[model samples]
Target chain A: MKRFQQNIRKVVPYVPGDQPDFPDMIKLNTNENPYPPAPEVQEVLAKSNAEQMRLYPDPTAHQLNAAIAEAYGVEEAQVFTGVGSDDVLAMIFQTFFNSDLPILFPDITYAFYPVWCDLFRIPYEVQPLNEKLEIVPEDYYKPNGGIVFPNPNAPTGIALPSAAIEEILQHNPESLVVVDEAYVDFGGETVLPLLKKYENLIMVQTFSKSRAMAGERIGFAIGSVELIKALHDVKYSFNSYTMNRSALDAGTAAVQNAAYLQETTARIVKTREHTKQVLAEMGFRFPDSKSNFLFVTHPDCDAHELFEALREAHIFVRWFDSPRIRNYLRITIGTDAQMESLFAFLRAYLKK
Target chain B: MKRFQQNIRKVVPYVPGDQPDFPDMIKLNTNENPYPPAPEVQEVLAKSNAEQMRLYPDPTAHQLNAAIAEAYGVEEAQVFTGVGSDDVLAMIFQTFFNSDLPILFPDITYAFYPVWCDLFRIPYEVQPLNEKLEIVPEDYYKPNGGIVFPNPNAPTGIALPSAAIEEILQHNPESLVVVDEAYVDFGGETVLPLLKKYENLIMVQTFSKSRAMAGERIGFAIGSVELIKALHDVKYSFNSYTMNRSALDAGTAAVQNAAYLQETTARIVKTREHTKQVLAEMGFRFPDSKSNFLFVTHPDCDAHELFEALREAHIFVRWFDSPRIRNYLRITIGTDAQMESLFAFLRAYLKK
Candidate 1:
């Protein structure tokens, strides 16, 4: 421990979700998509020439970024991709946020934000969510170096309206306002259209959730050409070929088959709606989520107790150890069969 | 540009050798292996399933690290692999060396060191190589927080004996002496054994050169468990799956075929010997190299002019813009046929 930087010592590591080896569990933790990626992804990956593996992947990830740009209606220069959204976020933190001024983020959102800030020796101020567990745009008006929080914000699955995001961008003209749209494709408004108006606006998205490519570790950012260039500089100076060649090939196929992603996301959203109705009928209080996950809490039900009981019944859900969100369970939306199993487990666990 | 970290402003990016479109040129500029990777690499990468790509790669990269540890004769806890040695080195700069204390590296070594130090806001002292282009271990004994230089010093192809390296490690008892053995398998002895004695030593090696897996982007470090743990903390805080699954699989296979690598490196070293004799016959001077590359300076010709002339003739070699090494050309050792063509080109160019 004495060998680490002073900042590293102060930071707690990011805890990824439990990747259980058992076959019986209906896995809803970590918000991974239950469905397989688009069939075209397999076709492209399988058909790739093995000889190409001898060469390094394109450092710019040009083709994948172009596909992402086409999907988001931006120029290729306005796009940047990394091994994953986490990778992209890490580079962004090191690139734009390391400053004398402190960064601002929601206290209840993705836990990795604080870890990254700590890792980069960046000062940060956490803005607490309002009483209703919503991020008020006004709260982010404080003068800071940057602001980042997931849109359709993680765990809570609440998305700020595009207009509200634009309002914050207007106020923080000098500071970079990064909107992490990791779950945006599942169900949420995106601030991608605002890139033309705001050079400091960067929207980060991942193929892991909707494209069902979490294992492939592909994440990208859409921003003005200048902001994207900054990310590029950091990426080149850090790890040029973060994404492997196969990933580029697979990601390009996934983006090309945008309809597949849309249909799958739509199916998950439908399943989530049905699952939410089931939870509501069972007397659970939860926020109306825009993302592909539901946040639920009950007065008498202990979150950890439910989490354990669900595990016993072969269902998995994410639980936070933090003070505010510890009482709630963030359940990922899955296939109808998985959701049915999950609902059945909750009913039996609650009855006990 | 105004928004980026000021430290990165003046940083000179490393330009990798131009991979030519024509197959005729003797391709030796970037020090890539002339041979193909192991057959297992192709088979392993072919198994990259679509389902796997949909998920995130293992943040810990346990499988690749396990393979590296097994090959290097260390515990997995003492090994860490990254996208490339560049990425791993970048993490090292941020994690261990980004302090007020000045870090140290050879003046004429891997050019990326100063770029990384600048990017991470780490102040560094460049200890110049002796007149013979040899890294004197005594030069590294100074008030420093860390030390790093390629094991077989780049361009010059000079290697520091493991005993000399061990002596330096003995002197810098408190500092992290990072020996980058990117070209080690070709000739130089690895300080892997020193890992058992010195907790402060970190040795980095890559599959790119000797194993012919550059395109796959796999590099790793062998060090004491505590140092590796610190690097792991930095890795997780940055990007969990820096190594793609296919890369991990291919790298694991590459290590398993060490005998094949030994055979290929032997062939390359033979070719290097043959080429060195040819260059010497043409009145060029260079330090004797132990790796798969040659560093030569011709008295009658400007190195830049020769590089340009070679490029015009569809031959490529690396020339550093740095003042100290500008007059020299770092040529990757190619096949016998490739070297013959290079010799023909030089002979003709010199006549012109």
Candidate 2:
């Protein structure tokens, strides 16, 4: 049976955060926005023609592409959309990170990066983040096939300034630099403006966190026409109709409602700050977070024990069992009421 | 610029038929079911909770999987779903067709097979169909990594019997045999019953044609638990949340209303037979089609010229420029009224 498997296909898959459905649960595990999508998105869904579903959706997804481009002030040709950031990043891995040279990424970043590398048979090297979980841009200056990391690195929520990203992009002129901004809209800055100077810079973002449409599965990449074209060439070959009609219509409507994105992310950022202060009062230590999630470690409590306790109490938060971040709990910033319940439970657990 | 791409990503893409949105034009190019999906699917879409879009969809898509399992009388573990049949087939190519040995398929079958082979860098051999445009079962007896072909084949809507399929499956126990039954519900018999006899037999089907939901993008595969596990391993590594919430809900609704599938496909089969008779009367030649489309060629007219004339007359049908089927047109069986309009034009043109 082992002989039947391909060497490249042998991979331990990335484990996504638990999606438990319970009436009384306080869910803050995955970094999904705690708000519904814009009202316009709902309106779009209501008015969508069911009869049109019999035909194939637009293969190019022109309306959504145009919406994204208009919002970001980029050309439509510079935008590439997929099912999610995972799909976009996978396509990027297949398109750009194929050389014999190892691509570089942070050791404690999004776990999906390594899985994709393994899936595509791409060689990759992990540059360790500093003790504060901050990415050392200089560490990525070495020669490599490509480089990629979340903007505000996942599970850590620490962000690198756009200037640092530009410096890294400047040093690696020949290789592509992928800045996954899945969490950037929470509070962090974007490297989108640098696209004018660096043609090899590919900034990926998702509607899951800010625009709040994770279940709809909309993610995209913005870059120079050359880079976008390369992604499109590989994407069309893989699956032309990657975006469904509902996603196309709903995502376009969400993008058009920029004010809604701003308001919801603002609320999450506020709640994230309040949660940070509460954690500090409870003797938790962590770096300042720019994203919607907080990565904190309590000196007295074991993360695994607390994770199980919280699960029993119907409060779901993420605790990675990896060696590097085993002691840390990555908690998403949910609504104000949900955060209050989580904090109250934490205080009681600490006392117990 | 060419040096930036991997050798495997460099290939011509499959050209899908034109999806021109015109209110007055007749669309029979792509083999999409002209009827709308079941009314229950529309109800599901309308009543879907907008707030639920904020969270990630079930990575396993258990509801849709259960619906498919119930429909096929298989266990839930034996079912796997994806964005579309193309996505399912691409994953199949990546997961099961990775050996150094070449896989086998018909030369004039689905055009996407070679494209998938090219994308995955999988070695393959195209066995030519018999003079009557039928697959020769004995030709596939050679050693191969895997085997895959549409059951009623494509463009050429000829079907091989279940006994013939079993003969091919019996000869190839070491490798996986994929039976793509995309058009089976139209008129052909399904080999799903053979799953009990052969663990290596994997059957792939889609809701795009028979259930009338191509724009929603739902496809699945049914096989032994071992084969399904291998596919899940690859799928989880690639994209965890491949199906969106609406697709999950709507596809489940579509499958539950099996009566709709039976009615629509029966209507298509009736229209297909009528179109074939009309074509034969007008000096056209084709095989006895068992799918929703007819592959026909006129003895007195050039296919390319006829296709162009049809396009100019606001009717769209597919024409391939490939050497094997260059003189043939693949006309999708539309609603009876649309088919009558097509026949009316053909009659006047042939008389001229």
> DockQ for all models, in order?
0.44, 0.57
- Candidate 1 docking band: acceptable
Enumerate residue pairs that collide in model 2: none
Query: Residues B1-352, candidate 2, lDDT per residue (tens digit)?
Result: 4334332245454444477788899999989999999998888888777688998999989999998999999999999899999989888888888788899999999978998887778999999998999999999998888899998999899999999999998888777889999999988879899999988888999989999999999999999897888789888866788899999999999999988888888888888888888889999999888999999999899999999999999899999989989999999999999999999999999988
Per-residue C-alpha lDDT of model 2 across residues A1-352, encoded as one tens digit per residue: 4323432255565454477999999888887888899998888887767788898999888999999999999999999999988889888888888788899999999988988887778999999999888999999998888899998988899999988998998888878889999999987889988999987789999988898899999999999897788778777765788789999999999999888889888898999898988899999998899999899899999999999999999999999989989999988899999999998999999999
Candidate with best lDDT = 2
Residue B159 in model 1: shift from native, Å? 0.9
Residue ranges of candidate 2 with Cα displaced over 4 Å: A1-9, A13-17, B1-9, B13-16
lDDT of 1 by residue, B1-352 (tens): 3343342223244433355768666667878887888878777766768776655567777778898888877899988888778878877777788456788888988867888777677888988898899998888887787889898989789988999999998887777788999999889999988888887788998888888877778888888787788778766654565676777777888898878888999999999998989899998899999988999998998999998888888888888889888899989898898999899888887788
Tell me the native contact fraction for each prediction: 0.38, 0.53
